[model samples]
Structure formats: structure tokens, C-alpha cells
Target: MLISFGEHAKVVRLEILSKIGEGLQDRESGDRNTD
Candidate 1:
């Protein structure tokens, strides 16, 4: 059970990181367009 919990945590972390990365990319593109 503990091992599965750890695996679930890792997956959550990866999802959060990917979301942040996508947000950053969107902001960068928006900045370019404004310029």
C-alpha cells in the first residue's frame, strides 16, 4: 500500500510539473505576440 501511494505521488508531481511547463510556454508566446 505504501509503495502504491508513493507511485501515485510521483504521478501527481509529474502532472503538476507538466501543467506549469505548459503555462510558462503560453505566457512566453503571449509576450512575443504583444511585442
Candidate 2:
């Protein structure tokens, strides 16, 4: 259970990082694609 939870947390963290990266690129560089 502990290993599973650790893996789940890693996944969640990765998702959050991906979202933040998208936001940063869009907001800071006007690099967002609407398509």
C-alpha cells in the first residue's frame, strides 16, 4: 500500500507540474495554442 501510494503521489505531482508548465508558457511567453 505504501508503494502504491507513493506512485500515486508521484503521478499527481507530475500532473500538477504539467499544468503549471502549460500555464507558465502561456502566461509568460504568449505561447499558448488554442487548437
Count of backbone clashes, every candidate in sequence: 0, 0
Name the 10 consecutive residues with the lowest summed lDDT in model 1: 1-10
Q: Scored by CA lDDT, what does every candidate get? A: 0.95, 0.83
Off by over 4 Å in 1: 1-3
Best by lDDT: 1
lDDT of 1 by residue, 1-35 (tens): 35688899999999999999999999999999999
Q: Mind giving the per-residue lDDT tens digits that candidate 2 earns over 1-35?
A: 35688899999999999999998877866544443
* Position 6, candidate 1: lDDT: 80
Task: TM-score for candidate 2, please give it.
Answer: 0.69
